[model samples]
Target chain A: MYKFLTTFLPKPLANIAMALWYFLLIIMNLYCGIAFAQGTFQYVGW
Target chain B: MRLLIEAILFAIPMILLAWTLPKKYVLLSQIIITALFIAYQSPLSFAILGTITFGNYYLLHKAVLRKSIKFVISLGILVLLIVSAKILFTIHDHWIIPLGMSYYIFRNIHYTIESYNGRIQNESLLFYLAYNFFLPVLIIGPINRYPEFIRDWQRRRVNSEYFSLGFQRILYGFSKIMIIGSYILSLKLSAIISNIDESKHWLKVYLETITVVLNAYFQFAGYSDIAIGISLLLGFRVMENFNFPFLASNMQEFWSKYHMSLTSFCRDYIYTPLASYFRRPMLGVFITMIIIALWHEITLPFLIWGSLQAFGIYLAFIFKDTPTSLVSKNLGRVFVFNYFCLSCVIIDYELAEALDIYKTLFFIN
Candidate 1:
């Protein structure tokens, strides 16, 4: 399994060994979006 | 208003699917999509959608596994569809563009093509529809290869983490669409560009060209983000269509960053073969670019847009074997990127006035 993980990923991305790494940063930022939005629709953009 | 309502309806089903059964849900999801398109009062397009779905489905089966004939006949049929439905928009001049036609059409034929190439395992009808008509990425797509997309679909088993991850993607998408995209859209870059006087501040043309490219990316990315976000809320994962594309250092990289799925589709289906046939890399790039332009619309501006990129990419390919590697690649990237943006600026002009606007670029008078 370790060998498989090393081979499957690009060297730069190998640190994110879990299968879900592609989405980790995105998930963190989503909470940031809600915090930024604070329920305001007018100037809050989208 | 209508866009907002449609957006809501779009997100609702995918969320439910994630909650219920993520992997198998595309089966249900596709059925809903076909039904929704019909309800959208574009029932006429049902023929177009249904025909493409079944046509490729049957043709690929016969051509590949059955070995009824080589791939030529199937390829020919797809080309004919492209010409009539996509190109002519109907010889009648009164036909409507099919709903979600381009994405689905491309998906259908592409699936068949890959299957024929032995790149994919046999997919069930359920997976097929989900791939073709998956609502999250339907209108705009980060088009998934059958193998990659299906793997993701089948493997998905929703849990709290999945919900949170999906929500995150959706929220991020909404931020791009509702906020930044709105501002870029409101700028109406083309309108501003058109009004600028040729005599003074003439650099406006270049500025406008740059602006048009930015606006287009934002608008497209914004919509894609919304799609991504909504699907997330529903606990489904849709691949992203855009990365930080403008940051792309070269035409090749730009494509990888921007509208990635479409670019990959074109590359797989069009570019590589053309390159191989010509035995001169430039020819393939040029021809492939034209196909990309034609996909945008059968118009001169779009053709020019596609042509310029092809020409630039061809130049880069020439530089591939050159000694001044880094500099040549960088120069080629800027040239293609600028040309791509400028061509879009011309495309932004009114169809009737496009020629005149183009003339203005040269004369500046």
Candidate 2:
């Protein structure tokens, strides 16, 4: 999967895709973090 | 929230210190940060951890220097007794087991065994302490080895590649925990299952069983990813814990890929020695499985779960030499996957509840 991304896509396009992916992850993390603080999200214990 | 907040707050300064300090002082910064974090979280646990760390270090040093079998045996038994006490205390709710006690003890056990074999190079008490209490792996671990960690420390360097990769890996870990495990598996799939009709009891049972196992995998693998990623950021390359375990086509393959560190530890320290001692490989397999089960919790369900896993591996061994085609390989994957999912019911529920689920799954009625 990594090879396909780095090899198949243009460097600039790959960079943009990577940045967007991180952005999406950060936004989702923020949402989950807030939900967790509000006691709506269940905790997964070790 | 408190734990998360504290971890982030501590991690920021810890990472900064690690980057700014001389390579030699990096381990010291980690030790201090870990001490602060544990003390802040629970003072009693902090005290307990400190005692264990220092005591084990003293014992290990003596064992290594004297090369005495007696010292090795005594130290091994002492650690086991502490772990057993922790298990019993957990069962009775009489006392709280110090956080990360399980992970660190296994590490201590690994260290002891290796030291006895004269494989350990760095006998530095400082390195041992840092290995035990390294913040990322202290809670949930890949159980990084002593030799590898020492090597990483010696060759540690500042690099942009490590930073980028570490950040990316951490993001992947959070995504697995938050989106995949918590939201999709725990909340959404569970809600869907609960809404199903009672008439489709078998379907509900199957789906719920699969979901439980998958959720466990994601939760564990996510924590491991976070731990490994943090280790990477510190310029240390720790062992990988999971490698697409669900894709494995047999019980042996699955065990090899899933929780790679712990299983490999068992293979090396538990299974190998026992197998050689008894001269009966199957007996060793059973005992190792039991130890693995007891490591999690000394409960009847866990014992049964471990036995079932051993039996699965035994069957796989019997068929080891059988010829395989593409169709057979796919079938094997499906069979192994379902077998694991169903067996997980034993550990996830009470005995009678698990029995009922099995009956429902197999159409016993």
Candidate 3:
């Protein structure tokens, strides 16, 4: 998957896509973190 | 949040050390860092874990050198007693199991068995300690083998690709845990179930069960991703723990994929020998399932859960040779997936609650 993204797409476009994906993950994590802080999210332990 | 924070904090220094440490000092640095991390988390856990690890190493070393079956048996019994005590204590609320005790004990057992089989080579105590205390996998593990770890260490080097891949993997883990698991399956699904009309009891129960199972999958697989990613960054490629188990078309395939490391370990250490001894493959499957179930917790519900799983596997085995087409294969996948989700209800709830769920599902009440 990494190779396909980096190789098939143009370098600039690939970089943009990667950035967008990372941005999505960061936003989700931040939202979840806030939910956790509010004690609305359940944390499962191993 | 605290665990995630501590893992990140631990990873940064470990990554730096992996990249910059002198060759001779790398092992020492790893040992010290891991020791400090464990001690910081809980001094009692550190002490107990330290004693078990060192004691196991010493006994294993002697058993290997002397090739003494008596020593090996004694060591095995001792380890078993410790694990049993921990489980019994936890069940009775008498004491807390030391951090990562389950994972490390299994590692020690693996080492002991392999050493007795002459599969293990002579290694220094420090190297053995490093393998046991390796922080990336200490808590939740892929149950990495000693030989693979030693090989990774021997050939380790700084690699940019590994670093990039590791970070990407960690990002994937966090996303799965936060967005998909905690948010969608857990919170949203629970809210949906609670808001359902009480008359739609079956729908609510089914959804709740699915939510619990899927939530467990994501949470576990997410943590595994984080552990694997961290190991990658540290230049050790640990074994993969999961492999898209829901896509399995049969119970055998599901077991092989879900919790790949643990299942494989049980297959190797438990099932094969039991099967050979009893000359009954079905008995092996049953015993292995029970062990896997009880490994999570020693409760009556888990025992029943394990029995149900074994029964499911037996049914699958009986139907193994049946002809299959595209539709049948898809049907098989659905059956396998639902079987797992439903069986999981047993382990997730008390016997009475689970019975209530089943009664509701079948309209028994």
| Stretches of model 3 off by over 4 angstroms after superposition | A3-15, A38-46, B62-65
Return the interface RMSD of model 1.
6.5
| DockQ of prediction 1 | 0.07
Q: Once model 3 is optimally superposed onto the true structure by TM-score, how far is the C-alpha of residue B123 displaced, in angstroms?
A: 1.7
Provide fnat values for all models in the order shown: 0.03, 0.52, 0.59
lDDT of 2 by residue, B39-87 (tens): 9888987887888778877776754555675456646675676667757
Highest-TM-score candidate: 2
Q: After aligning candidate 1 to the native by TM-score, how far in Å is the CA of B163 from where it should be?
A: 3.4
TM-score of each: 0.75, 0.94, 0.93
Give the poorly placed runs of model 1, Cα more than 4 Å off. Answer: A1-46, B1-4, B21-26, B62-65, B68-73, B90-94, B159-162, B184-199, B203-205, B231-237, B318-337, B351-363
Instruction: Report the C-alpha lDDT of model 1 over B180-290, residue by residue, as the tens digit.
Output: 444333334445667788775446756765765665676577677666666555445666688777655566667677787788788888888877888876777778778
Question: Which pairs in model 2 have colliding backbones?
Answer: none
Model 2 spans > 4 angstroms off: A44-46, B1-5, B62-65
Superposition error at A44 for model 1 (Å) = 18
CAPRI-wise, candidate 1 is incorrect
lDDT of 3 by residue, B134-243 (tens): 98898888899999999998889888878888888898888788888888887887888999998887998999999999988998898889889999998999999999
Cα lDDT over the full model 3? 0.84
Across residues A1-46, which tens digit of lDDT does each residue of candidate 1 receive? 3357779777546655543543554554454445445742222122
Supply candidate 2's per-residue lDDT for B305.
92
lDDT of 2 at B247: 85
